[model samples]
Target: MTDPISIVSTAMAEDTLRINTIGNNVSNVSSVGFKAQTLSSKGDVHSDLINNSDGRLLRTNRKLDLALQGTGFFVVDNNGQQLLSRNGSFSVNESGQLVTSNGKFLVQGRSGPINVGIDSFSIDSKGVIWVGDREVDRLLIKQPNDSMLLATAGNYSSASSREVKDGYVVYQGALESSNVDVAGEMVQLMAAQKHFSLMQRYFLLYDGLMKNGINQIGKSK
Candidate 1:
């Protein structure tokens, strides 16, 4: 059996981690395509936590501003490394390449970076990119088989087992809002702090009781 101090100590540690995650969510409340993380447990034992959820789509009415309407991610080229993101807010660079908010180039058709020379561009519901009267390239949108494979890396998420999704729909002139619920995260933050404090008090009380009992035994001897 576990000691009272041990139980409370473990609980306090878990509570601290949970509180930090909640704080992160609160901080990113206004960030586009931000997914709220969650801590999960088994019975009375707290274990792994993960953040991966669909965010609500918000209209920005800007042409380059894009959002996924279904299951898919807009691929980006950060330097030479490929990254995935749900944040479709994109802009053209000086070289005319489509880039994400973080300055990563947007991966387009033929698995290459896109460079539409003109500022005038429009994306249809099918993820096709059109400039003037010609279709330059189609946007590279992919989907992962599992949500667990998606993990936060810098300003975006990395995925495994990714496949180009042809059945996905892209929404032009919009962006996906962060899924973090500000009120809910605030409530969770308060509750976690309360639990941590209560656990600390319990641990202190247990330690005091043990100390008193030890001193009494020593005096009797």
Candidate 2:
């Protein structure tokens, strides 16, 4: 009785969540170095718990650009805490330290933030920092676990601590491209729309059947 309705309603709710995730991916299609997020449903019990996966790699030609080829994250310091990100859109600050577009200091070496004193800098393949041809600090690149979940505040939660790489590469004058595929997103959009429509039809049919049953009982009485 109520089971079917509950199933349909739960399915509809999950469909809505899927639509929202798809919408976000579509909106960020042209975002520089943006990673496309893929959503997955949890459990066979029709629950709405969804998870996302980061996919694909892209290349950008900005002199301040950076891209991580393998599984690693660039360490960023927001206030006094550390944040991790794959986005390599970077710039040199007045102090000559490499920073993100948002002005957060990029971590270098296994040590704390490296302070730069000049106006010119470059990152080599080994993530070493070059301040006008002089090696100052190595970029603090970390290889987080694959199952680690990256969250807000530029932080990540994983079973193991992040791996520091003294030899990870960072290319200046290039950016990593976004991972979203337009064709795949469009196909997902169509499927979600169809599922939504089918659920709505089922809801309507359930309503009509209940109404007819009530009307017949009243006539018999």
Candidate 2 vs. true structure, TM-score: 0.81
TM-score of each: 0.85, 0.81
Q: Which regions of candidate 2 deviate over 4 angstroms?
A: 44-62, 104-108, 146-161, 164-168
lDDT of 1 by residue, 1-221 (tens): 76777778778888987987788777878888776778776767653344556678898999889887666677777666666677788888788888876564655544488888765888888887888878888888766554432345324544463656576678899988888888888888889999998888888888999999999999999
Model 1 misplaced regions, further than 4 Å: 41-53, 104-110, 146-154, 164-167
lDDT of each: 0.74, 0.67
Model 2 over residues 60-160: C-alpha lDDT tens digits?
Answer: 55657776665567777767666667677777678766687877556555666666655566677877777787888777777655454444423344444
- Rate residue 202 of model 1 by lDDT: 84
lDDT of 1 at 47: 37
